[model samples]
Target: MRDGPAPGASAPTQTDMDLDLAPSPPRVEDLIAARRAKRQAILAKYSNGTSSTSTPVASQSSQAPLPALLIAEQSITRANSVAMSVDGTPAPEKYSQGERRASMSNSPPPLSAQDTAGDIGADLDKLDAADNLAFELAKGDEQDGMQAPDQETISKLEGGHDQISAADYDPSRDRREDEHKRLLGEVPHKPKVEDVMEIEEIEDVEEEDVDDMFAVAMGEPSKKTKKVKKTVSKPAPVLITTTALLDTAADAEGYYSVILGEQIDGGRYQVVSSLGKGMFANVVRGLVLQSPPEAEGILGAEVGKEVAIKIVRSQESMYRAGLKEAQILQKIRQADPDDKKHLVRLERTFEHRGHLCLVFESMSMNLRDVVKRFGKDVGLNISAVRTYAHQLFLALSLLKKLNIMHADIKPDNILVNERKNLLKLCDLGSASDASENDITPYLVSRFYRAPEIILGVPYDPALDIWSVGCTLYELYTGKILFPGRSNNQMLLLMMELKGRFNTKMIKKAKFQDAYFDEMGGFESVERDKVTGADVIRKIHLAKPTRDLRARLMPPTSVKMNDNEAKLLTSFIDLLDKCLALDPSRRITPREALSHPFIRG
Candidate 1:
């Protein structure tokens, strides 16, 4: 009967039979087809709001569904396709059950026995290759340490999401509703390409991004490691109110000297010593590299001998004044190069940095220094004052002929040549064209400010004569003749010393009300609002008892003899003429030169 059953095998076992008769494992195509069918059924049910009692597996498979392994593979392939085509074409439209069933049934029959085994192995290899490629890409991203969001992540950022209930989808719920309504044929919303790409492209931000964000939020400076921007602040303007912008010019000890032995003016001159400093300019003694004919007389034929360089600041008002002063010097130099008796000789003018530079012939010292050395005890000798005064008047006479007004004449403005016992007027910064009628009221030193200037009357060169008279009184007595604390007090001092202003002159003054009553006498001095001091009452009560003659006399230690008295009388007469209260009657420089006091 079958050559008898093998001696060991009695009958065919159920286990063996079951194993051999089991249907072949589902093929890759079968699994894919089954999954697609399942998805289509779900979509169809959702779209039409209908459902089948049949399970997805029952509808997709004729006999039985594949094992878990095959299901997993099907899920993976479907996921990849969905991700790849997120913004691509929509999936094939849902069809009738009959058509779907036909499609499911039409999947090619299982590969032939040999081919099926070979394909399965090849597919395993392909899956492995795909897995390796994916792993490699993921590894590369890890190595870089900075990863851009994938399409799905960016879609979430941009409020792209799957279908969900309004309550569940909080991010961009309005946008979701809008999209939903568009799909429902309520409105046509054509998204722009830029709108779609906006969030996805914002990826490659580094340290610079952090800095830019910080800058936008707060005006914070960036890290030192990065490039930095530099900003510069300008100096504020000084509020100047005083007549003498330079308070230090009167005190020779107040000089702030420059560094000695410093090269300047393109190395043509070297610093010798500091001469002095003022609010608007710095004067330094310099040595010339090449001695010109003009410099030879002042500094000798020796090269590298002393000269004076006045460096004026670049403030607008001060700069224009400096340039104007230089122009005046240029005019004087053109007019008289050989006369050292008049104005200080300007050797040349140049520019240094933002300052105006004036080179001048060096002098031993200024008249103020000489006055300081004489002290208040003995005071300056009459001979010295007479010599300096004569030189000053000669200069004034020349200036008058030139139609120039030396608006500021003070002790410090006069320079002395000790070697020759000669004097010259310097610092023509306040000199003006005789035609400049609109000159500022605050021009000269307060100690020497003219009566016309104080009362704001129309003034001319006669203002210089008043200033000279005041300066000469100080030179002789080692004290200011008026020395009022303020302009109002100064007018009172003028009245107290030289008597009241002429009623006509007072009427002609622009600032008459400031100093005089309607009756043309001294106004009751009012208290300073800021200082709370009775200014006018103090001035009225503080009138000096000593006349100009008594003030100019020497101390008891230095006796005044007959010769001194005669000299003093001539000096007093000259002073009285120079100190005339009336501008029309004030002594002219031409007239002052011929007086016995100066002529002697």
Candidate 2:
């Protein structure tokens, strides 16, 4: 009928005809019936404890068989057995066909185009039921003190099934439920606010041990509260020394009350004698009980050695200042490890009872004490002045090289050893970098303060030279060269000795308006004692009454020989260079060291 066949083609056979006339596709109802039959056979085999073969219907078309259903049916049967074994009871009878059919018809349609989508969904649902049944079996095994199935066995069971939808099966659901139950059992009861407040109040009461009467006597506020019902009786004030009255507790201003002969810093240092007290800190003589290993070559290391302990007030500002001083001291120590630079050495530092303590080498006395003891009103001998001046200039040279400024360089801040041979500079708490500007004008003592400071002009290391000149004069004459009660009076005294300041210097002064008129003439304000009213006074400059050399060698003083007179002349010349009115004209520490007075 179609031209017989090609040359190589065989004639049409019965089998070929049968293949060409393919049977119609299997109906949906038929596929459903076969699935139900297969599930029933699987259930019956498990129920009767016998092997039963299930011959699934084969589609005559190209559609693939659904092996997922057989796997789901086997899983369901195994789950039933697991349940029965766990509870020691038979599983319920297999679901009736009518019920199964109704459930299949009522289920939501699959969203995918695969013919087996519905079967896959049903298999997933049954797999979830099997998982739930397995969880119950695991719990039962745990209760019976039996080893449950390992993770490997469970993984095998999971691998046997098809990829199930995440919505239909969640392996972590049972674990999450168990965790929730455990967390509920372990929950702690919340404490009430009243209970918390009561506990805090108890702690506060326990910590309030300061004596109320002593606090009031010291002008400090009492920490006792109304809630503290216990009455504390006042005790007698404990007197530690004849001149020193010790407080029982810290003052409101954060000053730690000290007891004489008491040990501090874990008994490493013992308080022996009070050295002195300043605005920022107090100094006391301490006996070292424990010497640090690093203090091998440093002074104040051996046990029983006397060291000056400067305890900074516990106030926040003082603490920060103390830290800065310690840092500067450390920098100096590193720079002068040989200790040849005539600078006080800081041995170490520590904190005791919220106060910072700096340990320094103990010296016998300061230059003020030296002057008071040896010089009296007449001042130290010329030979002694030369020796002290040389050492002080050396210290200044070191400071200049380091770019440091000793803001407060008075006689009281320079110390000498017990031998009275070596002089060392101390009390650098007010020191700052020389390159820094914006420094306070009220630096150095009133007598030794530089003219630049009085004019409120930016200062440099030359400021220290001016102070050294004043100190040397005091050391030589046993008298303050310029002792002015007020800053305005000080300027007048300076002009009386050094003559009026240059007009250019006055123009550069930040406080020029206060001390000088717009015409560059000296003007000062004063309080009239009679009326207690401000009075503006204008000063007229005059030639110095006596030159520096004439002042140094007064007629009342003993006459010096020719050699001594020549030495005195050189000393006066050096002082003139140091006490220059303009900072730029002032002699440097190095130049001062090479001066004829210092070299001679």
Cα lDDT computed for each candidate against the true fold: 0.56, 0.61
Q: lDDT tens digits, residues 351-453, model 1?
A: 6555677888788776566656542422355665676677788778778767898876877788866322466788887788888865234557666778887
Deviating ranges (above 4 Å) for candidate 1 = 1-259, 291-302, 524-532, 535-546, 553-561
Listed in order, each prediction's TM-score against the native is 0.54, 0.57
Residue 128: error of model 2 in Å? 99
Misplaced by over 4 Å in model 2 are 1-254, 293-300, 526-534, 556-558
Q: Compared with the true structure, what per-residue lDDT tens digits does model 2 show for residues 1-600?
A: 212332455674542222211111233335437645755554343333311222233442222222333343344444445434222366452454354343333222221213233343355446435533321211122122111123233234435211111112222333233223332332212223333222112123222235222121222234322221111112223322111113323455455577899998889899998877665577898898987767776444888788899988776656787898999888888877756678899988988877888999888887777767665555666766777888888788778878899877878788877546577899887788887765444566666789898787899988999989988877766666666645676787677678778878888887777676554556544455675644445444544432566456534234546667677778889899988889999998767766778777
RMSD of 2: 45.3
